[model samples]
Target: MKTYTDTGKKDTRSGFGAGLTALGQTNPDVVALCADLTGSLKMDEFKANHPERFFQVGIAEANMMGLAAGMTIGGKIPFTGTFANFSTGRVYDQIRQSIAYSHKNVKICASHAGLTLGEDGATHQILEDIGLMKMLPGMTVINTCDFNQTKAATMAIAQHHGPVYLRFGRPKVPNFTPEDQNFEIGKAVQLQEGSDVTIVATGHLVWEALEAAKALNEESISAEVINIHTIKPLDTDAIVKSVKKTGCIVTAEEHNFLGGLGESVARELALHHPTPQEFVATNDTFGESGTPAQLMDKYGLNAAAIAAKAKKVMGRK
Candidate 1:
């Protein structure tokens, strides 16, 4: 297994902010719009440096989406920043009608996503944003795992011409991925190679999946690990190739099992591979107020949970 060292802990949203700041210096066409949560989304640097290009929509998420779409028409690559719930669920109609439907070059940059949004509770934690955005025709959904990858994805989406939903979180987690790495859309990063079972994970659960792989290794279980950052344009070839080698699969994510990465992997396996699969995700239920660690433990979204699920699926194989 390839080893990954934790350089430091940083929130993925900071990565998005840094990426946007870099784009502000280089990309003249890249403009930003925020729904009155610039600090929470970590977009202060970009806004301060390029006030002319930054639009503060004042808590109007739907209006922000419409504004971003309109800016795209004027040949500007607009990035709209807000919480996950407001980014998709609250303003989905505007996105669908104005952005996705028209294939506008708008980047819906969502922060504070999933259970890790912490004490904000179910009302704020938007686990289904991935599903909501992915279902939109012509929408590119990306859920990055760490700071480096999030930054890379943010920059990469600016180059791609289409509507994109980029999801990140507020909690500071392990920044393990390389600082200088190429970000490829619809490409899976293979973390480790094994023969017993395959563990495919995305977003915050990806680091947990890697930790689980290490634990499984101690028990003599050869577990392959793959980091699936892009959920919508899923890297099916990498998933299928790994599953074909292992014959069983374990999918981990921070979202509900109903419409998240687990379901996408399940559908792919059912169609092409028919491998035994186990899902390490939130059951179909809303989250409650708590610290990020507490919520992760209670909802079975941690390393131990992933390892347990891996062992259970390996038994079926």
Candidate 2:
């Protein structure tokens, strides 16, 4: 097995903060709205720099979405910030009706998504937001992998003239990828190329997928890892090509198995190629209060689980 370089650790939310600040300077029309989660969502930099352009709505996520949608009417690109649960499930109607339905240029920036939110428990940790947002019309759903990619996505989404759901996490994990990498929405990054199996993952699970790739390599099983950041407008071509080469698939995510990244990939693969596939994700249940590692192990979102699932998917029975 070959050794990969280890980058320093950093939280993905910081990337969003950094990108928002850079966007505030680059685009004067960019406005920010927060539901009293500035620190959690890491929007303080943008709020402090562009105070006049930021609206602190005081824990009212629904109201913040409405205001963000309204701001889009006057040539303002509003970014509504909050946690994943509140960003989507709590304000689905507002986002669906006012933002997606009305065609508002609002960036729904959600932090602390999935089990990595750690110690928040099930009430706040939402694994279904991707499915919820992706179902909406004209909504672009993105779950960035690391700090740099999230920053790049946040900056790029500001230039896109429509509604977008940008999801990131709170845990300080591996910070791979280039510092100034250009983030192209709807495009997936091919991490490791292989022919045995393809592992598609998003958010915190991308690092796990990388770890699984190393493990698979040690076991003499070549596996391709694809960072599927954009769940809504999935990279169908990349998935098709990878599956065609690999002949099997395993999906990993820090989200629920029912309506998250894995399901999206499964739905696409089912149509294009009926390949053997397995999913390493949380089943139909709520999250629990524990350390990130504990929850990940319990919910089967770690590297070993992904590797095991990959072996199973390839019919290594």
Candidate 3:
């Protein structure tokens, strides 16, 4: 298995902020709108440097979405920043009508996604955001793994013309991916090549999946690890190719299995080549108050959980 070293521990939201800051410098047409959580989302730098282009929409998330969509009509690439729940669940109607349906160049950058949001509990931890956004036509859903990937995805989405849902987290995680890597939409990154079982992951689970691969390797099992950053326009070809070699898969994500990455992979595999698949995700349950690590472990979303699932899925094959 290929080894990965953490450059440092950083929150993915900071990555989004860094990317937006860079866009503020280069892309004059790029504008940002935040719904009362500028510091939380790490968008203060963009607001500071590009005061004229930054829209403080206050706590009205729905209004923020409407404003972003309207700004796109005037050829402005608007990136709306807010919590995952408020970004999608609270403003679905506006997004569906003004953004996705019309194919507006609006980027819905969501922070504090999934169980990693922690302490603030289920109300803040929006596990269903991925499913909600992915269901919208013309909306590109991207759940980046770490700081570097999140920054890359943020910068890449600014260039893409269409509605996009970019999901990131609050808690600091291992920032392993290269700082200067090209961010390709709908393209899966193969972290390790193996023939025993394919382990596909996204968001915070990507690092966990790598840890699982290492554990499996020590056990003499060759597990393929693929980083799936884009959930909506999934890299079906990579998934199919990996599964064809391994004959089974283990999908790990921080969201629920009901409508998250696992479901998407399962659908793709069933249509192309049916195979035994296991999921390392929340079992259709809500998150509670705890630290990020505690929630991940309690909900069975840690590296050990992923490794256990990989072993079980391999046995079924």
Candidate 4:
């Protein structure tokens, strides 16, 4: 079994802010817009440094999407920042018609996603954002794992042309990945190799999956861990290849199981390979106000839940 060390703990939103700041320096055409959450989204630095390029759209998320879409026509890559609920649910119509339908080169960067948006309650968590965005025609959905990966993804999306939904969270997580990682969209990073079971995870759950793998190793259960950063344009080949070797799989994510990474993986397996699978995700339910740790434990979205699911799925193999 391979071991990973946490360099530090940092919020993924800060990584987004850092990436935006870097883009402001490197990409001349890059512009940012926020819907009354410049600081909450960690986009304060970019807004401050590039005031001319930053548009404070107040709380008008729909108008912000339209403005971003229009800016893209002028060859400017606009990165819109706000809470996940507002970024998707509140402005879906604007995004669907203006961005997705037209295939605008807009980056819809969303912060405070999933149950990790502690004390915000279900209305703000936006667990169904992934499913909503992925169902769009040309929308590329990305759910980054850690600070380093989030930063790398934020920078990488600027080079890609098309509408993108970049999702991150509020709570600080273990920063385990390399600082200089080459984040490739639609590419799955296999952290550990095992023949017994494969664990595919995304977002904050990626760290939990790693911890689960470590615990499984202690019980003599070999588990393969794969970090799935990009949800849409998913690395289907990587998932299929791993499951073929293991004959069973476990998927973990911070979103709901109904319309999340687990469902996507399940669909791929049903078509290419039929394998036993277990899901560690919110069971088609809304979240309540609580501490991040409490919410994660109550909803079974942590290492213990993942490990137990891995063991259960392996039994079916």
Candidate 5:
């Protein structure tokens, strides 16, 4: 079994800020907009350095979407930053009509996504953002795993045309991936290889999946771990190839099981290769006001939960 070390703990939102700062220097056409939550989204550096390129749209998230779409017409790459709940659910109509329908080159960078938003409660936490964004035509949905991966994804989206939904979280997680890694949209990163079971994870669950793989190894279970950063345009080929070797699979994510990564993987598997699978995600429920750790444990979204699911799925095989 392969081992991964956490160099340090850092919030994924900070990675976005760092990436945005870098973009301000290199990408001349890149512009940023924030809907009142500038600091929360970690766009302070970008806003400070590129004041002329940054727009504070106040609390009007829907209006921000429209403005971003308009800017895209002028050939400016606009990255709109806000909470996931406000970014997607609050302005779905504007995004669908203006961005997706027209294929605008707007990057909707959402922070404080999923249950990791913590004490902000269910109203602020948007677990269904990935599902909502992925359903739209020409919309690329990416849920990055760690700080390094999030930073890489932030920079990568600028080069890609069409609308994009980039989701990250508030809680600091293990910084496991390479700092200078290239972020490829719709590409799955294979963390570890095995033949007993495949553990596919996205967002905050990627690190947990790695930890789960280690636990599974102690029990003599060889678990293949894959980090699925991009939800839409999912790497079906990678999933199919891994499942063919393992015969069973387990998916982990911070979003609800209904429309999250697990459902997407299940669809692909059902079409190409049927495999026994278990999901480690919120079971169609809203999160409450609590610490991130507490929320993760209560909702069974941690390493222990992932390991147990892997074991259960392997049993069905």
Candidate 6:
């Protein structure tokens, strides 16, 4: 087992800001569009540094998405920033029609995702954004776990011309992955290797998987941690190999248990190698006002929850 920790705590959105600022200087066509939550989305730095390239659309997310799509027509790669719900669900039609359907080069950067958004409650926490965004045709979905990967992904997605949904979170979390790590869309990062069970997770849940693996290690259970950052074009080869070795699986995510990371992994595993699988996520229920840790426990989205699911899956097999 491997231990990866952050130097200190850093929110993934801060990484987005750093990446976007770097993009502003490196890429001339890179422009940012933010709703009222510029500070929350970490777009204030981009707006402050390059005022000319930043567009504030008030509290209108739908219009911001449309403007981003239009900017693509003029050969501009516009990155629209907002909360997860506002970024995807609120402006889904606009994205589906103007961006995904038309294949526009727009970067949909969403922050404060999943149950981790905390205190703001269910209305703000978007556990189904992955399912919604990934369903759209030609839309690329990428969820970064920590600070380093988020920045790297932001930078990488900007270079790739397509309708991309880059999801991060508000609170500080693990910053484990290498700062200069290369991010490949549709690829999964193998954090730890094991033959007992394969644990596939994404977003902040990736850190939970790592923590769960540590607990499993204490119990003498060998567990593999596979970070499925890109939920859409999943790393099928890695998933198959891990499942083939373990013969059982446990999927973890901050999203709902249905139609998100778990379902995607289950569908893939069912087709390739039918195996017993358990899921650690929200039980299709709404989130409540609480701290990140409290919401995780209440929603069944913590390391202990993942570890329990892994044990059950392995025993079932």
- Superior by TM-score: candidate 2 or candidate 4: 4
Measured on C-alpha atoms, candidate 1 has an lDDT of 0.93
**Could you report the Cα RMSD, in angstroms, for every candidate shown?**
0.7, 1.3, 0.6, 0.6, 0.6, 1.0
Task: Give per-residue CA lDDT, model 3, range 203-255, as digits (tens).
Answer: 99999999999999999999999999999899999999999999999999999
| Per-residue alpha-carbon lDDT of candidate 6 for residues 99-145, written as tens digits (9 for 90 to 100) | 89999999999999988889999899988899998889888889889
Query: Model 6 segments beyond 4 Å from truth?
Result: none
Tell me, by lDDT, which candidate is best.
Answer: 4
Once fitted onto the true fold, the runs of candidate 3 whose alpha carbons sit more than 4 angstroms away are: none
Across 1-317, the per-residue lDDT of candidate 1 in tens digits comes to 67889999999999999999999999999999999999988889999999999999998998899889999888999999999999999998999999999999999999999999999999999888888998999999999999999999999999999999999999999999989999999999999999999999999998999999999999999999999999988889999999899989999999999899999998988898899999998899999999999999999999999999999998898
Clashes of 3: 0
Better of 4 and 5 by lDDT: 4
lDDT (tens digit, per residue) of candidate 2 on 82-115: 8989999999899999999998899999998888
The 10 consecutive residues of candidate 2 with the worst lDDT sum are 1-10
Q: How much is the lDDT of residue 113 in candidate 4?
A: 97
Residue-wise C-alpha lDDT for candidate 4, range 110-228, written one tens digit per residue: 99999999898988988899999999998899999889999999999999999999999999999999999999989999999999999999999999999999999999999999999
Q: Evaluate candidate 2 by giving its C-alpha RMSD to the native, one decimal.
A: 1.3
Model 6 lDDT, full chain set: 0.90
lDDT of 5 by residue, 249-316 (tens): 99999998988899999999999999999999999989999999999999999999999998888889
Pitting candidate 3 against candidate 4, the one with the higher lDDT is 4
- Candidate 6 lands at a TM-score of 0.98
Please, what is the TM-score per model?
Answer: 0.99, 0.97, 0.99, 0.99, 0.99, 0.98
- The global C-alpha lDDT for each of the candidates, from Candidate 1 onward, is 0.93, 0.89, 0.94, 0.95, 0.94, 0.90
Residue 233 error for model 1, in Å?
A: 0.8
